[model samples]
Target: MDTPQRAGHVAVIGRPNVGKSTLTNALVGAKVSIVSPRPQTTRHRLLGIASFPQGQILLVDTPGLHRDQGKSTATAMHRWMNRAARGSLEGVDAAMLVVRAGQWDEADTFAYQALRQAKVPVVLVVNQVDRLKDKTALLPYLAQVSEGREFAAVHPVSALKRKGLEPLVNDVLALLPEQAPLYAEDEITDKSQRFLAGELVREQLMRQLGEELPYATTVEIERFVVDGALLRIGAVIWVERDGQKAIVIGKGGERLREIGAKARQQMEQLFGAKVFLETWVRVREGWSDDEAALRAFGYHD
Candidate 1:
């Protein structure tokens, strides 16, 4: 008897900062998407592929679904994110809805609504279980979240600590159909190196800068040239205003230097090659709200 192989797509839907990206990375066993503490860190629709002996899962990590977004770029960004996440759910064999353990907000409700509207089979992933002091407290929370909806399985896992992930992956893989793998066995993601490098830079900047300032920043890879064991990458950090640029660059360009150094180190580790990274900050003047600018920066579906 031979082992049956299965494979299909799984859309990991959730509000911002619910560990969706982290879970995607953990399941794939690689850094396919960038992660940050800030909301709206994942701007694009990312695919992280996880392979198992019995099957494989192509996880779709979308921009966080936001609710009650107000005027300006923030609203535009949230709408676009919701669009990306909703679009990912279409045609996917299953959906994984990640919500923080013991908490549910309006944004989470928005995400859940999208999942329900999609009519796709859902796996409710209650991430951050490791943060809970009383493990039994999860029982009622799980029951509440699963109420009035059908879940293939309710997995309580910690994307950060890697706890309870093995079972979660097993359940998710089982949700996929019995078909051949969609991507290559060793291929972790379907994104270009340039896009990933840009994401990495954005991730580091978001982590280093923290709060409000990082939201105004977006990364564009201007150049990616490979020479033997050395990789030269030039990235432009786009900000909506001069003050934001100044903040990103920091005093006498110190913050910019640190961002570059940290990003370069990650790049080297990711690509396994010496990296020559050149970063420059520029003011894009409300580009986030500008639909044309957003599309040009690859923010669209």
Candidate 2:
């Protein structure tokens, strides 16, 4: 007799910069979600489909759960991101409470509380274990976080290095009800190519820009056309002020060109086709806080 296939949704919940997107990409075997060192890099809830011989995991990658204080302002974007993270709990078969291996804070507690309220099985994922210098501390840290907490299982993994995922996957699969694969094995994510192209461009923005600029910026795909074996994409990088646009454009537009080049390379790799990506920076004057602007920029439900 063979084990039955299990398929279901798993909400990837965590605080900012805890490697949720990296874990989702590792599981799906593709870069379905964008990641940046900056908090709130993920503004929308996207699904990454990871298929295995025994089961399939539908990962809902969300923005990091953080309070509206500190470096992040209480803008409409922040509110939207928080809503997106919380809304992911609904209809999930299980939840992965992702946190740093050696650190647990109030934000992590807040995420755990949110998952508890969801009433679904929570698998505590202690991510970024590779970065821990003191390996002996791992046991104590794990014990500390797991104390008085209910977790179906706890696994330490390095999503970037693709370490310790097999056991984690097995444990998570066991929690799911037996069913057939929800998506085709070849399918990686629920987002379309157009949306991904915009995200790739935004990923470059998050990677290359300075501290505050990336947060103040958003990308929109104005054009996505398949020209034979190539994809021609036009992306508009929206900024909150004219000064920000000048900074993004940089000296002799070199900065914008570099951003486009890197984004196009990522697009080519992900799409497995040639990509011609053009980017332009435009000022929207406080678009981050304006509800109408956010909706127009494709930040709605």
Candidate 3:
């Protein structure tokens, strides 16, 4: 397919675990963002470019919007969400408000309210239809939202299953104004190699840690050096408390070793080079809420 000369930015904003990252990967036709079942898995604003037949769409996958309690990592993540949303929406040609199909709650309303306040041309993307056994049940909820609103269009899609995405892409491209491509044709994402490597480690850690540890942990790549055929990396995994650190390290450091091996393999595939990854766990007492620590770890306000 001939690449479309026209292009514009499209911001994907939604609440936690609503498949925002999944939809981003699907739309971009690449794994630009790490996907996990856990909420707030995305901590940074990731840019993924989708080159459609009609045009290239720069999809800015923002962190999920949520209320913060001024304590813990959740608050820091919420701040990141606000920062990404407020920063990226300016002068964008279009926006997609992604919400889970069957789970219409107060958080969805908050996301909608924020989008409405942005005053950008918005499209409501109802995602995760695969989870709904009775797909028709979503109609009433859809109708309730559609009434007296200025949504460019409402699209129900399954981001994970790759269903109903073509229409969404078409609608987003149609809304975009004619312009030059914002990024290079070969570029799939805007995050650095180190950032992607750290995220891959974090993704593996999230899966291993499950519900109890995913929210409390933050992975940072301390060192990355390429030596010919081998890529050497050092990363530190930060947890809120000493007990959590023990949990991550596991019995005789077996679990942490497993996590490192899995992440290194994935990093090798991502960089197309052999990887030597070294990871260690650290207990940073309330590091999530500490302004200096958060900033140092790349969680900017």
Candidate 4:
């Protein structure tokens, strides 16, 4: 009797807000990462495993890559994306480069370049096809970008509408070598409960705050204690400046309370237990630039 072989990893690399998290969640049939309309919402590589009748597919949801001007926070996020993308391609069976449909911009060009450099069996996924009025309009752009390059396949999908995903999944599985499951069939994601809870809080904040705050905020779970029926969790929301902290807490603590309540509701749904979540805003001056702070927050390698 020997251990069975396992399927290899599939890295989903793309620019920010291109529906990477949405596609990862859809593939896994669960929410493993926080998704916001804001750019660079995904700060780390989240592994979501999708199990099919044939085999398992491990999806790596990475942070969006973009050029940052002077924002230290954005610079760090881009570094994270580079790290994940490079590391994931090392021995991956295949890679999917997600690009927004109906656009051929600098960001898309950068993404294409990165994928070309990866040298792995790649699939070009044109996401947000639902936004395209004329689907045929995408052909010229796709053909132009893919002219001299080798892509296992080019797929146009709407991650939001769950359109054109089945084919993508089937194609990905076909590329994987015949092997045993890399992860337990029941385990859908590699993220911990604490990480998921923090992400849920951050997602709500991102939705409510919008671009008023950059990706300078981080949520850390200080304490996660389970006492019988209730979960007692304490988290600190770190901001880069006192002004940002003020904005997060808001006047009379109303906004902070609202964020906490919504986060608690989501946590309960995630944990399947009543949650008592306490969140506090702390100004950690220049946390983005501080190497110690970045390492402590699990942003750095």
For every candidate in turn, the CA RMSD to the true structure comes to: 1.6, 1.6, 2.4, 3.0
- Candidate lDDT scores, in order, read 0.87, 0.94, 0.85, 0.82
Candidate 2 clashes between residue pairs 3 or more apart in a chain or in different chains? none
**lDDT by residue (tens digit), candidate 1, 175-268:** 7788888888889999988999999999988899857888778899999999899999999999998888888988999999999999999889
For candidate 1, what is the lDDT? 0.87
Candidate 1, residue 122: Cα displacement in angstroms equals 0.5
lDDT of 3 by residue, 1-301 (tens): 7554678888898888889999999988878799888887888888898986677999988888776556544565566667776677776778898988877778887887777887888999999877888867888878987887779999999998999999888888888887777777788998889999999999988888867778788999999999999999999999999999899999999999999999988888778899999999998887766768888888774
Summed backbone clashes in each candidate are 0, 0, 0, 3
TM-score of each: 0.95, 0.98, 0.92, 0.91
Which 10 residues in a row give candidate 4 its minimum summed lDDT? 68-77
Candidate 2: Cα lDDT at 137: 98
Q: Can you write out model 2's per-residue Cα lDDT over 52-136, one digit (the tens) per residue?
A: 9999999999988876653356888888898899999999999999999999999999999999999999999999999999999
- Identify the leading candidate in terms of lDDT: 2
Clashing pairs in model 4? 5-179, 5-180, 6-180
Instruction: Give candidate 1's root-mean-square deviation (CA, Å).
Output: 1.6
Best by TM-score: 2
* Tens-digit lDDT track of model 4 for 1-301: 6533447789888877898899998888877877888877887878999987778889988887665555545455456556765566666788898988877678877776776777778888989988988867888877887877788989989888888989988888878888888888889898888888889889878987858585778889999998999999999999988889888898999889999999998889877899999999998887776667878987754
114, model 1: CA deviation in Å?
1.4
